[model samples]
Structure formats: C-alpha cells, structure tokens
Target: MANFSTNEFKAGLKIMLDGEPCNILENEYVKPGKGQAFNRVKIRKLISGKVLEKTFKSGDTFEGADVLDTTLAYLYNDGEFWHFMNNETFEQIAADAKAVGENVKWLVENDDCTITLWNGNPISVTPPNFVELEITETDPGLKGDTAGTGGKPATLTTGAVVRVPLFVQIGEVIKVDTRTGDYVSRVQK
Candidate 1:
C-alpha cells in the first residue's frame, strides 16, 4: 500500500485509517502560534458511511486504500442484494442493501450507475444525475391547468415520489433529477 503524507491529503483521496478504508472529504492546514503545523481532516468511512474528523501532525503519513469507481449496468434486486454487471466485461457484482442505501430508489434495470469499490467489493453506489420514468400514480390534473402553475405529488415507476407539474399525469414519463428528487419536465415520449 502507498503512503500519503499529510501535505498530500486532499478531498476524494482514499486512505486507511484504523484499519478501515476512508475517503477524505476535507483537509485544512493549521499552524498554531507556538506549535508545529497540523492537518485537520474530515473523512467518511467507505464501508459504514460514517463521517469523522481527525487532526494529524504535519508530515504524518497514512496508507493508501485500494478504492476504485466503476460504471456498471443495474441488473435486478433479489430482495437481499442489488446486482449489477459490467457491460464490456460481462462481469457481475452484488451489493447489499447497506451499500446501495437510498440510491436504490433511483435505480432502474439497464441503467448505468457508478459503483465505488473498496478492495474489489462494493462500498457505495451512485445513481445517474437524471432519469426518465413513468408516473405510476397521481391525481387527475385540474381543468385548464396546462400552464403548469402548481405542482402535485406523483409516484414514479421506480416507487420514488416527487412533486410534478399539474399538467403531469399518470402513465406519463417525466424527467427527474435524482440528486435533488426534483421533477425536471414531462418526457414527450
């Protein structure tokens, strides 16, 4: 494993801390009036999704973690694990509910997702920025509301609910921003 000195610490850098893999979220250099310089870092554990803050003396080193991000196509969820496959390699990997977390709501079969792997195993999953899904359920739109003056809650095909324009209706496909769970617009198709 490679060692990362405190000076080289930066956001998104993966390192081993207390035998666990963690990604640096923030690194702040601090120097007291009379003491040596130090680095204050905020990191998130790869496996448990926990955030922690720690301070290290200048020039301190940490072992690098074996972490990689790969894009895979979602296959299916078998109740316990969500499966994904590498389109080019045809290799498949299973991630447990903990790894998928809330992103599972945005996942649809055949969709490409970025999976973060630690030591060759999935630690986290990231859904795409936008997705188009059919509205499975929603109240009927009011008459003459085609101008989209207001919004109403609508259930999507993937089971995630978001506020859509009044003109949106059930069975209509709408574009959604996954990161904010906001309705972008009604899909023409």
Candidate 2:
C-alpha cells in the first residue's frame, strides 16, 4: 500500500517486485557524467528464496511489502510442520519444511527463534546465533588433548555434524555458532 522511492532503497528493506515480496539485499547507485543516474538493487524473494538483480531510474518507486520479524519460542515438529509460539501473546504458528530449510537442525525445544512473516504468514525461520547442544555421538576424547590442537567430527543431538576439538567427547554439551557451524567452546555443566 505504501510506496518506496529509489532513494529509500537499502539493505534489509522489503518491497513488492513483480507481485512478490522481496527483501533488498544490496542497493548501489550509479551516476554518469553525461546522463541520468540509476540504482541497482539485489533482492531475495520471500516465498521462493530466490535472489535477483534489478535496475531502476533515480526517481522510480516500488510498493512496500508487509514484512515483520518476531521472536517466538519453538514448540515441536509434527513431521509435516514445525511449530512456534509467541511468548507474550501465546499465539502459535506453523512453518512448513520449505520455510524451515536447513535451519531445522538448529532448532531445540523451548528455544527462542526469529521468525520472518509476510502478510501474516511465515516465510522464513532463523535460529539463535549461538546454541548449546549435547554431542550425541563422536569418537572418544584423546587423553591429555585438552588444548584442542586437533579436531574431530561430532554429531549433535539435533543431527547436525560439526568439527570439534579433540578434547570434546560424546555426551558433552558444547556451544556452537549456528551461522558458521563452528565449535565455540564447551558448556560448563
């Protein structure tokens, strides 16, 4: 319903393009010595997760998209859908496997997650930046290897595998960076 001029284009801005909601990933302006200037925008489609680039004249505009981000506590997956609830309102929503994507591996019961909604429906789910999950399987820890000089692959409780220090062992809880899937440190207790 709202219009956004090219001047307002910036990373993270959401607007409608070709009848679909798209989030602006990058916006670059170009001006020539002899002609008019234009803007190049890189955007990602909300529903399909596709990225594309478009160019617009300096004064062009686009319709604003109805996008919102909210924090919700994850409930559980019913094989077909993953559920989440708003702690304050107790409102619940379900996201299909497409919406969950690869983030399903980082979800843990009762954990808070960032959910992106478009037109009152979820389009994407983001897990916490860092999570502490127990190592369900891995090779036995090497004796006197507390320094973590060498690393080994560890399977987390959520089924995601990551390389951890040699000192890490199965059944130990460790903090991991969800964004990079890197081992951060061991969780005390």
Best by lDDT: 2
> lDDT values of the candidates?
0.91, 0.92
Highest-scoring model, TM-score = 2
lDDT of 1 at 46: 85
TM-score, every prediction: 0.92, 0.93
lDDT of 2: 0.92
Residue pairs of candidate 1 with colliding backbone atoms: none
Clashing pairs in 2: none
Candidate 2 residues 1-189, lDDT tens each? 689999999899999998889999999999998999999889999878899989999889899999999999999999999999999999999999888999999999999999999898898999999989999999997767875476899999899999998888888999999999999999989
